[model samples]
Target: MITTTSLKNNRTFIILFFFLLSFIGNAQIGIGTVTPNASAVLDITSTTQGMLAPRMTTAQRTAIASPADGLIVYDTDLKALYYYSSGSTSWVVVSSGINPRLNFKRIRSTDNLATVLATELAAGGGAKYVLNSNTLYEINGTVTFNFPIDLNNAYVHGLDSNDDIILRTSGNIFEGATGGSIRSLTIRAATGSVFNLNGAATQNLIFRDCIVANSASVGTISGFGLVFLSIINFSGNTNGITYNNISQLLLSNMGWFNNNAGTYEKLTGTFTLVEKQGGFSQVDGTAIGFDVSTSGLTITGDAVLESVVFTGTNTAGYVKGYTTGSYTGYNFNNSWNVRAAGIPTETDANAVGDFSMDYTVGSGLAVSFTNNLNPSNTVKVGSGTPLTTYSNLFRFSTDAANRLRYQGKKKRIFQIGGSISFQVPGAGTYIIYIAKNGTVISQYKIYGRGQILNDIVVLPLNATTELVNNDYIEVFAQRYTGANGDIVVPNMTITIK
Candidate 1:
């Protein structure tokens, strides 16, 4: 019933109507299968092939204009999948395997450290960066930071020497709230600048093998254990640091060279120094190594110093302790020449034959001569007097007292030997004994006899005893069985070594 041309036109019209319906309905297009997944807009399923993303070099990928967030690209330079992050405003590398370099945020001297740290914090969910202990952050140029870099409980290590990483800043460059450490770095601060500021008291901070130079002040440190090892402070306006309300401050092998101020000031707790070498190389008469002279600056505990050497002229001496404070414990040992004002110098050992006392009685005693061993006067031997031969550790009470007091800190053994020549009024027995604090020691009592009246008798007293701090020793003689008449004592000599 229809012609051939009419049939062909109807077939074309039906095909065009179906194509327009598919376009208007937003249909999914599948290449290999008739049914496509509902989640995908374009599904290409093949058994022998995979989908290929847009591949470009790092430069080409960055050159893309106005790239949308979540834009994916295969980076040929990094050999990793890169995704654009709008929050960080950079391309983030996506990898299934762990990369060691990801743990470190490499910073060049030209790079803005604040910017780099901010980006790193954003990527790390605002947590502080943890410095790797074994890694070395080599900085070639001077890195100046305006804001404080808070090292939240991490060990920041630099190159082999402090000269490699030079930091210059006007304000505080480093701070820590919890705990941290910095080693092998040189910091140069201008006026009104502090090198480090600690915020907490329960935590500790340490600095080793570092140089702090030309600063208004170092920083106020309040912690449990603040330690400085092999640190050098050069040319600063004030002291190296101030420690307040701390538990312990230990300094070992520290050198303060040509600094305008002292090494430490405002010290408030236990301080221990070992093998410390420094002095006022500038020959500042007012400079001191440990300055506690400021009013109300008191150390609450002991200060132990060992093997400390102070070279150039320091008119004020090396250390100054608070006189009215409760800081009385000072222990020094082994080649430490610390001239502390208003504090006694403590030595480990006395010189050979240094502490010796000698006394002699010139006149004779009356009847019985009970306990008359106390010398009436001192005898001069060579160019030294009786008391002059005694060192600072030993002191003679008076001419007739004949008592030696030990004023040293350590306990020592002493040998006491003397000869007493007396004429007994009647034949009997006599005893010569050593008394410590008015108590006669039974083992040191020596007995002698006088057979006839006016008989000359000699008694030798020798004893060894241990003497502690503040102990005094004396010699006494008593007539046990002699007549009550006058007993003449010709000569008596006592020597303590």
Candidate 2:
């Protein structure tokens, strides 16, 4: 691993090195066209004129820089220096301090070889050499490159190269064969390092879009960096509204940080909402910068979240339920009052034809379920059959005015949640007289719309309190339809908002 401490903090050293190379190149130490035929030849007391100057038939000395070098001597009368190359496979006595053919040789060969012992004698072991088009083989060792503390617009590929290669924009993301792993770093600005997944891949990597404004630097020496389908930083600005729409959407910025040692540290930036279409992301930790806030806003829809949010400050919501009962312009605890036709002396063709009273609904709303009645069938109010006559009495009971007596037999009533049995009253439409028992209560209806049902009758609980001396409990069909009378009632459902 390359230690950050190894980096020279002295800017003067770098600038000075540049000056020395420039002046030395133009000055003349000794004038002549000195050249060497062999690869590892060295000479002392050589002139700068002999080493440089154009148009001279001088073999280009492979000017290579080396970390390891061995000592060599030219003539005892001249200065001394050492030289090494793959050819000699050992150090050779070259020009002394007078002409130091660099102690190292630029091994420019395309052997595609691994672990080649090029130089035999040296201060250190064999120095790994690299050329423009040549591969820097890792061979049997791991190579680690630290990030430039002040890199510009670089991102963590996180999977691009084992050797440290901070990916720039596009194109160069993946050039040739990449083995091992390459990780990446993230930033607040849009540097555009996104990778093209459509291209050929030789390494493994994954870059996930973040939900925070700023993420930290990329971790690890990457073999390859992955940046696909990702966005840059964002500024959070949200609009709070409420309405019913097809869908609702929410979005957040990607959180980023740098690792100090192995601990991940936050990167700095402002948090803002961006236009991510219908996408949403939730990330942990803060983008190092201040002024970041938490967003708990809600978006609602059957499918995925779009741009709008329903049932939230920036969104809207709706209601649904069952519509019940009718408005007779009277607010009374009207129990399900059912009445059969009076016993008429004039019988239909055959007395066997029974005349019982049944109920049908009115436009206003409501119902009554008096099926097994001791009384017969007959229609009233506006005479014969009407359109409202065919409504289903999801719940059934008798009229409250006349009241009811519970025979203790369970009467089945259908409702939204399910079905339940209860004791009502009357042969014609009875009332279950709960007068003996103290006050008792029940949720008239709940699965859905109770507002509409409330119109016909407020819970008669208050009414029961005002019950006169003979005031008992009974069922009253407000304007519900589909009962036993002139109308043939069957399964029917009523829905409301």
Candidate 3:
């Protein structure tokens, strides 16, 4: 057994056995007996039919044979996804769809309104697709939009008077389908291209924060029996991002560009008028007082100019509109930094001339009156609602330095009397913020003691103050508590005037 000839034969036999093991082992997948960079050949066999061919499990070999349909294909890097038809087995990158998201990977005809995006392996194998995670729907007979529902429901048909189907996405352009709502709901095509819809009679549409540049495909828009609010570029004018012109259209709160690029009627920088077929009127405010903003501009449309009995030149420059309302002419103001008043010329006077409203006059405690405010100097409380406990008091004041104590006041500069409440503990600094329509107007900081009633938490924001008429005022207050404060506030009485 220990002979040299037998030992040599055993070594040779072991070496040959190792080569056989190499071919069968799944642990290591190599190309061939050739070098590591040699061409790869896969030997994959399976009993299943119509099932996917197994991919090359070997990482060392780069290329893998494609599936029969080929749509179930994928690349090393996932970028574009595709679908392979079982019949023709062709690939489709774009399918009729809606609401696309980043993970969206594939496409299919069974898609409903809620079915959103489809995506998967970049190489497009496995025929992967993703549906709308949040689903969509058309409405049943319920006309009102109580809330959004699944889009796939059959009763959610989207047809309007003109027989155009409309699709509505929040903060998105309204693209009508073939037979539901009016087609004019889509983005306009080009300058002067006509999109006449004067025959429409439906709901008042509120559109905001959008763009409608003129397109050759969708021309100038003309319409009837429609209320349009805040839709930019409805006029088919390419110049301004937010401009619109409609015939027999009711408009409100909507800003328009001063540049009269394409109004069929003559317009002035001061006033731009259009024909009013259906009577229009609102809360009148003309000539009660002059607005602090711009002056001396032209007015177009049904707006009135100086009316005269005869052709004579003996009257002062004055005009009134058919509607009993006054409006500010176009103002060239780009800055939002509204000024603070009662600061002795420190406020930017220029800002007052840009806004359509007036500037503030003095400092404040604050006041509230729901009914009527007489006594020009007094804070009149009519009957709004919700009387103030100690919780609703907001105060803002300054110190010896001209520097404002409230950094928020410095940023927003002014506000309507909103609500302010506070929590005082021992002695320290407290900050109060002022706001107008939920926006930050100003802030004030105070140093004081809050040991009055520890358990009794007093809400901060108190008397809501707002200037009547063109009236406006700046509010100011000081926090008596020092930095190291533990001060107690007595029943604080705010002086309203």
TM-score of each: 0.56, 0.21, 0.23
- TM-score of model number 2: 0.21
Per-residue lDDT of 311 in model 1: 50
The 0-to-1 C-alpha lDDT of every candidate, in the order given, reads 0.57, 0.23, 0.27
- Per-residue lDDT tens digits for candidate 2, residues 242-314, read 1111121122223212211111211111112212222222212222221101222221111111232112111
- Candidate 3 has what TM-score? 0.23
Worst 10 residues of 1 by lDDT: 375-384
Writing each residue's lDDT as its tens digit, candidate 3 over 6-108 gives 9999999998889768646533334332332223344333455333422321121123234345433332222333444446534433233221233222212
Q: TM-score winner among the candidates?
A: 1
lDDT of 3: 0.27
- The candidate, 1 or 3, that scores higher on lDDT is 1
Ranking by TM-score: 1, 3, 2
Instruction: Give me the overall lDDT of model 2.
Output: 0.23
Question: In model 2, what lDDT does residue 105 have?
Answer: 21
For candidate 3, the C-alpha RMSD (Å) to the true structure equals: 23.6
CA error at residue 20 for candidate 2, angstroms: 47
